[model samples]
Target: MTFTQLLRKENDDIFQAIFNHPFVDGIGKGNVPDKAIAHYIKADFEYLNAFMRIYGTAISKSAKREDIQFFNEQIRFVLNSEIHPHHNFCDHIGVGYEELQGYALPPTADHYMKHMMYHAHMGGLGETISALLPCPWTYWEIGQELMTKYEPSADHPFYQWISFYADESTGEITEEMRNRLDNIAEEASVEEQKHIKEAFRKSCQLELSFWEMAYTCEKWPGKEKVNS
Candidate 1:
């Protein structure tokens, strides 16, 4: 099979796993506690910002000028659409506009950010997408699961967020990404295939930790501050 096919298979596997997760139900129903959701949203944006800084620095230092410029533009587009608008999540959860940034995130939170930096430094944009795709795509796939397993409505936050990113409303997926996956597949050796498989698996495993960490911090006992 081609690399594109294999890449799709890998994404499918991860999405299926996430869709079946009990936590996914909370996401679908928008049943997640507001404080927890707020914290997660803030943490996610901070993480993305840090990731871009690392990636931008690394590429500028080593990549050809044109390639660096192109990747920077793509990353800018992603951040502008995905991260900035997502900040309004705090307001949805009853927090003040400035309060979200002051919230202290879990210490282990940087693992994903650092890993992304390392990957971008080593592998550039295509590899960067390989590492990044699991999160958004997983959610999109889980939305499908939620739709299949439960009734849908306009008020449901699950449908709101999922549809925002995955459906025609947002147009998150791009033809460039499709071509990149196809090219990677066409060029990959057996060893590279193994590496890609492992990277996808590792990325998923990290994703699980990411969710679990947020859950733990919010649910932790005897905490004086709830939102931070």
Candidate 2:
């Protein structure tokens, strides 16, 4: 089995929990509170920004020219395609860029982004790639399963978001990235492979935290809520 496939199989419980999470199920039915969805989108925007930087750092750390090109293309997709339409969606739902940008990241958000960035900045190419793999792969897996259950309408609030992952094209991209990760694994030393797998597992756990965070609209610790 491919490393990613093994990771998925061994971590099936986490994936199931994430896929079954109310945050995801709600999106599938288009019934999540706008407040919750808005919070997720805002946090996701910041996460994507961090992803771009982490991806760029991966490109710099790569020894393979093809991997560099792949990173460049993926980064372009994030900037050119993934993010702008998201901004439009947020605009439609009353999430302003300034509001999103100025808001502090939730604890889960802060921890997850740091997790990816650590591998990107401090580890080798294998660690970087593995650290980054879970998000897109898990999203694609979720989208495919959700699409089987729900056909989104054009006016559906999250239609574009769902489509972004459900697109036939995205599966190819996810598979290609996974293959690259496997290749990186094949080339890695035993110690590096150990670190890479640990990174992948940690990212998967963080992904679950992300969904729960959105579900609860979790925020960092702060002043106690004032009773109205």
Top candidate by lDDT:
2
**Off by more than 4 A, model 2:** 84-92, 224-228
TM-score of each: 0.74, 0.90
Q: Write the per-residue lDDT of candidate 2 for residues 46-157, one digit (tens) a residue.
A: 8988999998998888788988899999999887877754664576667675676645678899999999998888898888988898888888888887777888777877
Lowest summed lDDT window (length 10), candidate 2: 84-93
Task: Note the Cα lDDT for every prediction shown.
Answer: 0.60, 0.83
Pairs clashing in candidate 1? 3-185
What lDDT tens digits, residue by residue, belong to model 1 across residues 90-199? 54566664566644446555777766666666664456655655555555556556766666676765556555544643334433444554566567777665655565
Q: RMSD in Å for candidate 1, one decimal?
A: 4.3
Error of 2 at 91 (Å): 5.2
